[model samples]
Target: MRRRLIIVLCLAVVLVVAARLVMVTRDLPAQLTGAHFEGLRPEPNRLRAFLHRMPKGGDLHTHLSGAVYAERLIAWAIADGLCLDPAAMVILSPPANAPAERPCGDEAKVVPIADAVAGWRGQTTYDLLVDALSMRWFLPTPAVPSGHDQFFSTFSKFNPATGGSDWQRTLARTAEMTVDQLRQYQAENVQYAEFMVTLLEGEDRRRLGEAIGSEREPKAMLAALEQSGITAVVTQKVEELRALVARVDEMRGCAADRTRPGCGVQFRYIAQVNRNGAPAEVFAQTAVAAALARAAPSIVAGLNYVGPEDYRAARQDYRTHMRWIGFLAADVPVALHAGELWLGLVPPPDLDFHIRDAIETASARRIGHGTAIGFERDMDGLLAEMKRRGVAVEIALTSSDVILGVRGRNHPIRTYLSAGVDVTLATDDAGVSRIDLTNEYVRAARDHGLGYGRLKRFAFAALEKSFLPAADKQQQEQKLQRAFAAFEQEVTDDLAWPDWLAAFARALLPRRG
Candidate 1:
C-alpha cells in the first residue's frame, strides 16, 4: 500500500512538470522575444512579429486605380459576366463609343499564369483597351512612350472601364474584396497603417474631361458624373472599406480576446485628382476630402492630387493650384505626389520647385514620391522646412522602386532615412507592382537591413506621419507604447508561474471566461 501510494504521487508530480514544460516550450518564441526584445533573432518570423507588434502610423500614399488588386478585378469582371478574348485575354466592352469592332475580339479570356506574370509587368503588353481616360493620352507617335509614360498612363486605360457602371453594386463587391484584403493585410498591411484608401470620384472624372479639353460637351459629362453621385459614391465606398476593417477588428477580437485593445489603425481617402485633369476636378475632389475630414472621424482623412506634373494647364497654373490647395489645407489634410519625375518631363526649375511648392502652397501634410528631393532647389532649405513641419514621406518601393530595380536606383529612401526624414516604406500599387505590405516589410528587412527595433520604429513613424489628428494620435501612440511595454514585461519576466500563482493565483485568474 505504501509503495503504490508513492508511485501515484510520483506520477502526479511528473505530469505537473510535463505540463509546465509544454507550456514554456509552446511559448518559447514569445518568451525569448520578451526576454530579449533588443537582441531579437533575425529571420522572417521575427521580422513579422516586429511588424505585427509595431503600431503602424499610416500609409499616406496610394493611388486608387492601381491600389485595386488584380485578382479582385478579374473576379469582379468575371462576376459581371464580362467576356474576354482568348487570344489577348482582355475584357470586351459594350459598343458605346467603340467602332463596331469588339474590344477583346470574339474569343474567351484566359488567365495563363506565365503570361499573367509577364503581362503584369510592363515587359509585355496585354490586350488592355486604351481609351481617352482622365489619366491617359492616346499617342500618335512612340516618341513619348517610355516605361515611365506607360506607367503613368494606365489609369486612363482602365478608368473608363469602370465609368457609368452601377457603383453601388460595384461598391458592394469592392467592399467584399476589401474584406479579403483586410484579412490578407491583417495577415500583413499596405501603405502601412494609413491604408491609403483611394476613391475615384466626381471632380477627378470631370477633370479628366477637362484635361481632354474637347469642345465635345463638358456640361453633359459633368452632369452625368454628378448624377452618378460620385461624391456620394465615394462616401459610400468609405463605408465599404470600413466593412473590411471591421472584419479585421473582428479577427483581432478572436485572436486576442482577453486583456487586449482595439485596432485603431486608420483608413484615409485620397479623392485622386489627376494633374492632367481639369482644374475644376482637382478643386472639387479636394473639397470633397476636406468636407469628409470634418464629417468623418479619424477614419476619413484628407485629400491628394496624383499624376505626372507635366501637363500644359497644370504647369501653367501650378502656383495657382498650390494656392487653392493652401486654402483647402486650412480644413483638409493634404498629401501630394510632387517631384515624381524623370529627366526630360520637366525643366530643372520645375522639378526644383514642385516639392517645396507642394508643401508651401498645397499644404501637403505628407509628400508622396519625393523622389527628386535631392535635386530640388534649396533642397536643404526645403528639407529643413519639411522636418520642421513634420511632413513624413512615403517611399513607394514597388512602383518608384522599380526605377531603382531596373536602372538608376532612383529611390531616395536611404537618403530620406539618413537625413531624418520621417520615412515609411509602402507598396504604391500592389496590383500593378505585384506586391503587398507583407512584401514591402520583407523587402525593407532584406534590402534595407532594417532590424526589429528599427522596423518597430518605422511602424511607429507611420502612425506619427498619419493624417490622424493630434489628440487621437497621442492616445493611440500611448496605447501602442503601453502594449509594447506590457508585452515586453510579460515576456521578459523571470518569475516562474509557481511564484506568481502562489502569491497571486486568484488575482491573475479571470473573473469569467
Candidate 2:
C-alpha cells in the first residue's frame, strides 16, 4: 500500500510539471519554434540579440590564435615592442630603420609602436595593420577574392608576434588571449571553450623525430618512442600548459569568484598537430600530443590535427596520419579536421575519404568541419554509422561560407540533423571569419531552419561531447541545465517583448474578430 502511494505521488508530480511546462511554453513568443524560425529572416538584429542571450554551453571547435581579433593582436604587438612591415603589415622583432622587403621599396621602414605613438602616420599604419592581419580588410562587395588563400595566409602575418622558441612567452600570450576571449564568450553566455593550442617547439620536434626515426612497425615505433625520454620533454611542456591555465584562471578570478564574468567559463586546451608538416614531423608532434594529453589531462584535454586538407602533404599522408592517431587512440582523445575541402578545391576523390578515415580509423569522437560528408562514399551508411557511434560534427556555418561558399541550402546541416547525427554549431575562427558563437547560432536559426530548441540541443551537445572528465562533465551539465532552466523561466515570465516585436509576433498568429 505504501509503494502504491509513492508511485501515485510521483505520477501526480510529473503531471504537475508537465502542465507547468505547457503553460510556460505558451507564454513564449510562438516565433521561437521551428515552424516560425524562418520568419526571423527580416529581423536580423533582433534575432542576433535573442541568440546572444541564449545559453551556449560550450565552443568545442576554436583556435586560440584565430579567436583573438586583429585589433587586439596589433595592440599586443605594439606592447611587445614588435615592429611592423608597412607593405605586408607583418609584425616582427625590431630596429626601426631595418631593410624591408620590396613593394614598399627601399624607403620601407619597420615602425615600432613607441615611435608610431608620436606620429599620425604611425597610428594610420596601426589601423592598416588590423586589416592586413584579418578578413576585416576584405571589401566583400560580392565575396572576398581568394578568401581561402587569404584566410590561411593571415596566420603567417601574426606568427612572429607569438614569441617563437620561447614556450613560456607563448604560454603568457595564450593566457592573455584566453582572458580576452573568455570575456567575449561569457558576454554571449558561453560556459566553456576548448581551445586548439599548439605546445611543440623546434627542439622538441627534432628530438622526438630522431628518436622515432624510420620505424615501420606501429608497436615498435610506440615502444621506441616511449623509451626515447620524450615523456620527460612532454612533462615539462605539460607543466608550462598547467601554469598557463592557472594564470588565465586567476586573471578571470576563477579561484576567487565562480560567478564573475569569464570566471564561470571552464577553459581547457587541446594540443594541435600541424598536419602540413613532413611525415616525421607530423608523427613526432602526434606523439607529443598523445603523451602530453595523458600526462596533463586536466590542462590538455585532447589532441587535434589542423591544416588545410587540400595541401599535398596532408592529402597524401592522410591515412598514414589517421593510423598514427589510431595507434594512440586508446590513450588520447582525437578531434581531426577532415573534409574541410570543397569541389574544385581538391579532386572529388579527396573529399570522399577524409572524414571516413578520421571516423573509422582515428576513432575521432568529434569531427571538425566534416563539410564534405555528402561527397563521402556511401553517404547514407556513413551518416547511420556516425549516429550509431555518437560522433558529433562541429559545424562552423560562417567559416564554411567564408572558405567554401557553402551555407544555407548548400550546407549539409539539415542532412546531418535529419540523419539523427548530433550537430553542434561553433565559431571555427571567429577572428578570421569575423563571427561570434552567437552569430553562428543566429545563422543556423535564420539560414538552416534551427529553432530555439534545436539551438539549445546543439549547445548541450557541445558540453556533452567535450573532453572534460566524467565528473566535471556531470557538474557542468548540472550547472548548464540550471542556467537553461533559469533563462527559460525568465523568458517565459514576461516574454520580454518590445512593442514592435510583440506586434510582429501577434501578426503571425490568427486574428480574433
TM agreement with the true structure for every prediction? 0.65, 0.87
Task: Encode model 2's per-residue lDDT on 383-416: one tens digit a residue.
Answer: 9999999999999998888778888898998888
Off by over 4 Å in 1: 1-57, 85-89, 92-150, 153-165, 189-192, 195-265, 297-299, 310-317, 403-410, 449-451, 482-513
lDDT of 1: 0.56
Cα displacement (angstroms), candidate 1, residue 294, comes to 2.7
Provide backbone clash counts, one per model.
12, 0
The superposed Cα distance between candidate 2 and the true structure at residue 356, in angstroms, equals: 0.6
The models' CA-based lDDT, in order, is 0.56, 0.80
Expressed as tens digits, the lDDT of each residue in 129-156 for candidate 1 is 3221221233434653454555555454
* Candidate no. 2 TM-score: 0.87
How does candidate 2 score on lDDT?
0.80
Please tell me which predicted candidate would have the highest TM-score against the true structure.
2
